[model samples]
Target: MPNSNPAHTSKYEESGVSQTGAETALGHLLKHVLPTRQFNTQFPVKADIGYFANVIDLGNGQGVALCTDGVGTKMRVAELLNQYDTIGIDCVAMNVNDLICIGARPISMVDYIACSHIEAHVFDQLGQGLAEGARQAGISISGGEISQIGEIITGIDLIGAALGHIHLDRINTGQHIQPGNLILGLAASGVHSNGLTLARRVLLGETPEMQQERVHQYESALDRTLGAELLEPTRIYVQPVLEMFEAGIDLKALVHITGGGLLNLLRVQTQNIRFVIDPVPDVPPVFSLIQQRGDITDAEMYEVFNMGVGFCIVVEHANDAEAVQKICKQHSISCHGIGYVETTDAGHNEVVVPSKNLIGSGSRFSAA
Candidate 1:
């Protein structure tokens, strides 16, 4: 049977090390391996901005919008590849996708662009990509800010806020998540704009010849260059999800798997629920290559990257699941039954990996 323990033997294991020492090293690694914090600390909740924004009753419905995310080191990749068009799409996808997590239908977005010196072509590409992304998400680019600080800025920084509206009665805030609720995964569009720091460290660290060779290998394997593959526009699911809700399907919870990966599911507020992801979707070729090349552990990969599945919706165990799946299929998107929820300690939380091994397994009852 696969080892239930989170610790796994690595290629670097030495024969002379004592079991206790090995266990200590493994434990230390695990401690830093997973994201300890609940969410991204960089994106703080802004209460002051809401003072002047237009208000919609959304009648009893929660305005489940998220002002989360930044372009991160992906900008460097775009700079290196001399491609600025797609990064704007990523900026929009990063925030709008989070808005949909709580069953919010994205209505409008505003971007923040910071640059030391803005070139005309760069601005044009960014604008084009943002327009394309907004069109795909069925939202409007209401307004945005472009700050020019010759000293404070470097290349370019792109971030945005997405506004979404959901009926209070229709929001999937995980309140309905029960022990038997099914976890459905929506496949990602290649990396969906996270974990580039590690990818650059691992894949781009080789010699020039090695870099070219690696890129070629990735293209052959994944049918796209490593740089292009990593920059694939983020999948926008706002319309599909909103349509599902409009059709009267009861989605229990929705999760946008970003920097925290599958662990993001923990952000949902439902009592006594534990998630068991027994059959995760296959990891895309790019991720497999990175994992094999860097010798990254499963826990580390999930913590740092979205793997293959970008978005997930927790739904009831009724025939409506088929209807939801059909809608996703009509959009040419793939879905999978990743796992189910179970009643555990009142506030205790657990994420059981496929090997029956618990990684971010811990008790949240005290905090809850």
Candidate 2:
């Protein structure tokens, strides 16, 4: 089991991102934002305020799932490496992956790009990446806006809102997730889009010159330059997941393990259950490099980065788990039954990664 540190500032906070701060700030924001849900009764909101995605009842027994996300400090890597092509894929993956959690089949997206200055090559590369991502997700880029707000914007900002379709009755609100269900983890391509701030601060360096020196160096374990590894595009799980939906697999819950790591599993609507992840997959090489370089704790690493799993699916029966694995394998995604959901004596929900001796609740993970 991993050792626990005493209460103090986490290394991630030192990197300039605060998980607790964000939660508090978000609460204040939601206080103002959630009331707007009553503004339009014709298309009532289907999901609650903070599921992976929100669906709007469109009448006629249909719902449209929608979500918006952007590439975070991972964009800094693109700016540093002069690579602007792949992050569009990251932007797309971030939004669409969330939509799938609600069992929506993505159909279209609109993008918004804000940059300090208009650079022709950068825009061209971004378009190429967006086109490719849309192709992979089987969605169309309906429209977009590009703005040159030099005073307000820095290098660049890429964000998109994705829309997907689902039958009102078919929305997977995770209400069906039960104690006997299994948790299946899907492989991540690399770091994905989360935790890059800490990753950069640790692996590259805090100073610009130091980061420049390190980003270009070849890493033997990665077999590529450090910047390239960091810039790797996020994997889009739409096809395989949609196939599972089409196969009549009882997907009780779908989780996109993003900024909160394994703790994202708690977003499911189920109650009085804890997810216990044992026999977790091996940590990928890039994450290992970050941990060793940063001297980060196991609890912190699992709470920040994906470690290895990018996505998780909850299914009621063992046979359903096997069917999910088969579908993912056919799609070339490595899937494993890493854990099981169990009834918890504690009233609140939790995520327990036993190998690391860590337990997570609400917004953060602590050493057990």
Candidate 3:
């Protein structure tokens, strides 16, 4: 969290999600599940535990990264609007963005759609979004599954797995993210695929006043129903971040700002350093709209939403910061020089944003 926006008394109480319980379950799962995946004698497991993507050796000094993620409660927004096209893009973005965090170039993806029953137009619309997302990421839609489990579930849940390859020498596991490294922030499209449980709880009331509020369009950054803004697809960083690599900008760390907002920065670093982020990017109108409706504090907003910076990069050399800015401009990505890595004065692996009164030393999210 960037600032201590007085923890919402109901942050965990009324919100329908339990990040802490999920992490505890994951910890238990890792203990039993990880011990069984033995290293490949030929393509040995190079990186699996404690990182963004799991890397198993692919022989001849090459490795493969595989990551899978699903469109979470954002799908509820799609359902609320009776729109089904763009949620597939959220599925791809959630998966491929995590794949790139380990410096792998995404090559292909496979989608999974589970619904009570598939409507013909809904299927076609979902496929349209998937195809467009694949084009944006420069990856193939290799294969997928669509199942109608009548009693097993409700509406369609879109999920996907992305695969990428990298030379072992090119892997960036944040092992070298040392003190004094520059942190570069990338702009988000809008609340990219997380925290919808709280959003829906606060925004989806059935009262006449709530209905009026949902349809009320804003004058600032957004011009649609609050529900429409919630349905915006997650942004995919594969192409531009790949361009950064092709441009020879050696990034030491990459953080995908999903779920836990600024605290996602901890995922790309060792436990010995602290991140001091100054002056977060301006919150997009959609997010501000949610804050106003929910009566959410700045700290809580940063805790749940991306707060505009969708992705982050760390570079050891200060001079590389300008090169990064120039290249990102060529791609038209809004890049901000937000913060830097430095030795921890209090604890290990913490992110402190004084302006926001947030200290992200520990994240409530777990990508494991």
Candidate 4:
């Protein structure tokens, strides 16, 4: 259990991330941007603004799923460690994982790199990482752009847009998730490119010099340098998920648990239901270390980080849940039945974790 001391300021906000603030800004931005669907009536958007990915109907019973994501502050870890290789994989994982939520087969991606300087060796390493990520996702790096703006970008920024193919008839909008459906959790590999701002502040110290010194220091708890642990690339779930699709498993909702933790479960298309996570997967050591060191509350930890589970799959039948676990097993990814859904008339969705005494509404979680 994490510390529930209210005396502690919101750890994530103290680390300079305001989830509520971001949501408020996004709400305002979407009100103006979401209306752009009228701009192209021929290929209108299929998914709403807040879904993992947006699908655009392309006619002929086909649709294209599109999403964009970046490595976020995880890139700073790479910069401090001077290891650019795995960060590109994080970039690809972040984008393609979202694309798969809509039951889309990721086909291709285009990367955008903005850097203060164009060093050949760094670019080569980033390219290698991208290639490895593409291979893992079974997608192509069809194109990219590099901007050398020394004044604006001190180190580098890596972002990408992924486009995937989905049969218009088979798009998963979570409309099928219902009462009695089980939630399956896939294990995460370390932090997986989120909450780094808070993580760094907690584990490695706040200042750059302190972080630089601590990054190379080994702790018995992790049995590795902090930098190495933090640098673990985001796991690419493309193969296992696509295999599950091919195996005829009906995945009602596919969730990439990035940044928002379990609260992300409420982002599905289903409404007026409550997700009850009774038995969360074992808390990974790294996350525990962060919580202990930061004196962060359990609610704050789950709100900002993946904690242990990185991805979630919702299935209606017990056999389908078993199949999901088996598929994940074959891929060497750990899976568990963490919770179930129940129909509710509360007029809004909620995520309840009984073990933690936490219930989530909107973007944040609080003690029950």
Among the numbered candidates, top lDDT falls to 4
lDDT by residue (tens digit), candidate 2, 224-294: 99999999999999999999988999899999999989999998887899999988888899998888888
- Runs in model 3 deviating more than 4 A are 1-8, 39-41, 206-221, 345-347, 364-368
Give the better candidate number (3 or 4) by TM-score: 4
Write the residue-wise lDDT of candidate 3 on 232-344 in tens digits: 89999888888888888878898898888888888764767888887666777777766776777666677677888888898988678888877778778889789888887
Report the C-alpha lDDT of model 1 over 284-368, residue by residue, as the tens digit.
Answer: 9988877777776666667667889888888886576787888899899998888888877745566666552445543111111
- lDDT (CA) per prediction: 0.71, 0.91, 0.79, 0.92
For model 1, what is the error of residue 76's alpha carbon versus the real structure, in angstroms, after optimal superposition? Answer: 1.4
Predicted structure 4: lDDT? 0.92
Clashes of each: 3, 0, 6, 0
Model 4, 231-296: lDDT tens digits are 999999999999998998988999999989988888899889999997878998899999898888
RMSD of each: 8.5, 1.3, 3.5, 1.2
Model 1: how far is 181 from its true place, Å? 0.6
Model 3 score (lDDT): 0.79
Task: List where candidate 1 sits over 4 angstroms from the true fold.
Answer: 1-66, 206-218, 361-368
